[model samples]
Target: MNTQHEFKFLQYPRKNFVRNNWSNLNGRWRFLFDDEEVYTHPSQISQWPLEIEVPFAPECPASGIGDTGFHNRCWYQRTFQYSKNSKRVLLHFGAVDYQAKVWLNSHFLGSHEGGHTPFCFDITDILSESGEQILSVCADDDPLDLTKPRGKQDWQKDPHSIWYPRTTGIWQTVWFEEVSEIHIAKIRLAPQLERWEVGCEVFVEGPCFNGLQLKIKLSCEGKVLANDTYEVVHKEVHRRIALSDPGIDDYRNELLWSPEKPTLIQVHLELWKGETLLDSVYSYTALRSVAFSGDRFLLNGRPYYLRMVLDQGYWPETFLTPPNSEALRHDIELVKAAGFNGVRKHQKIEDPDFFYWADHLGLVVWEEMPSAYRFTHDSVERIVKEWAEVIDRDLGHPSIILWVPFNESWGVPDLAEKESHQHCVQALYHLTKTFDPTRPCIGNDGWESTATDLLGIHDYDDQPERLIKKYGSNHNIADILTRYRPGGRVLTVEGYPHGGQPIMITEFGGIAFVDRKGSDTWGYSAVQSSRELRNKYEKLMEAIHRIEIFCGFCYTQFTDTFQEANGLFRADRTPKFSLNSMARATRGAGYSRGELTSTPQPPPLPAPDTEI
Candidate 1:
């Protein structure tokens, strides 16, 4: 195996399960748009007139075909060389929008739904005798379909208010790998911070055999932490490996993960049949915990205030797909440099590379589901299914602190009056908790929240005085929640009270400053000069810091997306003001000196009733 090639591919694609020998099929591919949906199979298409860059959708400029028109169907074809070997071949797709049907050498491999999750197919038996394989894909994404979780992709011919161009076909990496017949299929790591142990579940796939064993080794830096071996009788094995606990707080703090210090424990796994090593892979995880205690958000068992920015995860060249792996790391770096410890990924389920970078770089993330515009049985089923896949794919990442299933009642529009809509919100919340009981879940984020662990309000008042007057004290907060509506919507539904959940202003401060010329640009408020923008930002931060009710806050945005010029930086990621100035404003007076303390504890509130 080429060590350099392996290193290059392992850095970005699927950090959880990585092997030495694999192939990255991410270059040019034959592409064509089929609006009529006439061709059922790859053989029916006689010609491929367009050449598109893989992983980048056609609506973006990086795809080499920047056509943002309404095309529901598209086709892709490519060829690669592979020889029959003792190892089994697996073809993997990072993601494909809406629906996708794949074919290898004109033979149907499989089909996958949901645009945000990954799927793979075993192609070992379909390899051609000539050592060449032809791969084809058909992606069908209806533009006007309101039942699918479309995120911010606009359905109209032109981009509107908060929505941008539609991302049609493949928008993520496509690769292949070779594995042994009996290899480790999957693994889920659960870190027990209090017990000083890591719980691991390993899934094995292949023909049953005797004398199979699995070995796991964990380390940090150059120091070995734990090494254990388990006998594999069945397919899945679960065990908790204990780590030597340092009795001192300072020593244990060194091992814990936080925004100030990110320590990842490197993981290495080996599968053996008797003395023969069948497979080996490398991964990493961190020990971290996030929860709420008496109206305060706690990180690593201590109260921690979250200064987060809303990240849409979009680019000028690539709509949803990142231009490269380095870009993903760069975005996280920029967020941290601006003095934010976390980010609320707005709608889209971002690429795995983004999550990997955040995990490695010590940035907490709130993973939100893309919203479907309409409410229906099909919409509910689609969102629920896709949300499950999302949770499954991101369960192991320690950086993801919260799961948001619905945002501002996008799908359940009648959440206030209709019993079915109310049930939908409660169902998603409970379902998310069922899937991931470790982290908190927010049912409806912005407003009209029915069942949620956190009460998130969206207020773009624009005036610091008004913000202070509105949320200066607990009395004001109570009035706002009960009587006054923030964005013309009640904070919680009529039947649901506050319930003593920690409150946070999830959306605010969308100050637009048009540094460049663009007629389509808009924001909640406008500033004429950079100085004015900086001053306004400083005042807003000051007011938010003064608020006694908010446990944390997420600023409107991190970077300027298309037609939404409310970001701290321009669309190209150039800062409107100096980094130091922005950082100072973001971290108000005495923030670095640890003047901030936990919010006042409210009376013990009863747990929400399980029955809806």
Candidate 2:
């Protein structure tokens, strides 16, 4: 299906899981900007007065070039039709904002500089056997580049405070992949639900790899359980496979995945030279894990509290790009119907169809890393090579399960007396545990923390008996920085030493709901009704549920992005308190700061391109 969107929008436009070829080079192109960054592609411009729209972002007004200032060069042209006969076409690019340069048919064909991962280019001898083929793209983007990661976008000209507009060129989805040069380049999937098993690395691409040959399956609804077959002999291949891998033993431990049951399993590899199959793909995974214990947050091993929220994956009209895929499954079923079992996607690196609708609707992502507010050496080599290709393209997503890699200290701000900013946050927390050593790798989230497994903090304290006397118990780190975090912001950065882990108040209650209307209605305490926003959100979740040394809390968002109004909805997502009173002030109520719970409300969730 080659989507050209004039707007009946339901397009996931390929975030991988292709079976029958693939095409969708989004719609209406031919645009021009070149604010002196000097034209480099689009066959050196030959009059394209402006049309914009492919994967929206001409500072999006559904991209008819709303031009919200900051230009920095741009050009995009389109024309497509391949009439298949592929040997290796491959031209995908589901992202492009910082630097991109391509031209096919006019032939230049390559240039990608990480605007949030996904990149490709093969052009198979610049194909031209039948009709149409033009495809051009040029983007440069630098809204005052702080060395490039540019998350909450905006660098002045309009949107402010926690940044907002400024995205250039193709903002995701522009495809054309019909591979067969011995395909399947990459698929990690570690899994292992405490050894029920599943390793599978696989990374092939043409010739040598000892005559190829690999197959694997692991179904769910169609039921084939698990199967295996290997012998690729090097192009990176690992293996494990085993739910009980011989015939799958009647649901052994029955398909586990959580946030209250997410399940998934389906994958299907295939590639062969010795048998002529050549290549195939269609993936899926989840058996979930997410560990950490002492201050607790287990998951398949039990505890699991994280009622998170921070979601800055914006979209008053596709800012960080996502207005489809059922508005990313209605923003993960409206954060699991306002009770939040997870979502800390804060500095934005979202849209893999929002981690496939948060792994098929159960939700629990954290996956942060999108900063670069300048710390030099090319912003730590563009944040460790685009945060290790966005954690190797979202490490087999079992709804993410945490891997922040620097937040609060925006881009290594004197990381506690800089030893090269604590060796660039301990080399992005040991390269995010050497690419997914089973999730949870904070290293720098909320406060000044250095190497962390989770000790995040950012207290906005609208008093709930002073957040129950500052985390109700253990107090070290200069009395948790001058008695319960008094703005000196310290959590653990003087040579990292709070090793009990799990402390997440990852940015506290932003409050603000006073009559909404924006000119930046801001937050961090504004309430003037909805019964004082449910009595200060049930007294700040009853002081993090009577302390017990706090295991989780993310709030400070989940809508109202754009001059951040302390959203608990309302930035056009209504609900200023009442998804069953904000899911009983965040799930399973009890310690009541008194008078509220009437429960019933649940209706208003429709307009995400309507349907339902």
Clashing pairs in 2: 510-524
TM-score of each: 0.96, 0.36
Q: What is the C-alpha lDDT of each candidate?
A: 0.87, 0.75
Q: On a 0 to 1 TM-score scale, where does candidate 1 land against the true structure? A: 0.96
Q: Mark the regions of model 1 whose C-alpha exceeds 4 Å error after superposition.
A: 1-3, 474-477, 591-612
Q: 378-442 in candidate 2: lDDT tens per residue?
A: 88898888889888877888878879888888888888787888888888898889877888798
Best by TM-score: 1
lDDT of 1 by residue, 194-269 (tens): 8988888889999989889999988887588998889997877899989999989999998898777777787888
